[model samples]
Target: MNLSVEKCPRCKAALEVKENPSCKAIVIKACPAGHYEKEFHPALETYIEINKVP
Candidate 1:
């Protein structure tokens, strides 16, 4: 379980992901600073799919 702090694009707040799944997409919540975390799914080799919360 790797925990990292990610920056929110909206307000630049520090976000974190506790557990990262190997074969599934994970959703990160927004911070108290009004920054929304972006969703990400890792693909084979060197590909990634990013999803944003509308």
Candidate 2:
């Protein structure tokens, strides 16, 4: 079972993760209040904009 890293940052409310069986068990964490966080981000542009390999 994947655990949430922390409680809701906005309201500090309890969070729960639900799996969508129809969608191939996609995990979604949510709080009682309408608050959510972005857990994924692609850095393609960032990689092109900044070259760290020197």
**Whole-model lDDT for model 1 versus the true structure?**
0.51
The window of 10 residues in a row where model 1 has the poorest summed lDDT is: 41-50
Show the colliding residue pairs in model 2: none
lDDT of 2 by residue, 1-54 (tens): 437465666677665665556654334466556564322113322211111121
Q: What is the C-alpha RMSD, rounded to one decimal, of candidate 1? A: 6.4
Task: Give TM per candidate.
Answer: 0.33, 0.44
| TM-score of model 2 vs. true structure | 0.44
Q: Candidate 2: which stretches are off by over 4 Å?
A: 1-5, 37-54
Model 1: how far residue 20 lies from native, Å: 7.4
Candidate with top TM-score is 2
Question: What's the residue-level lDDT of 36 in candidate 2?
Answer: 48
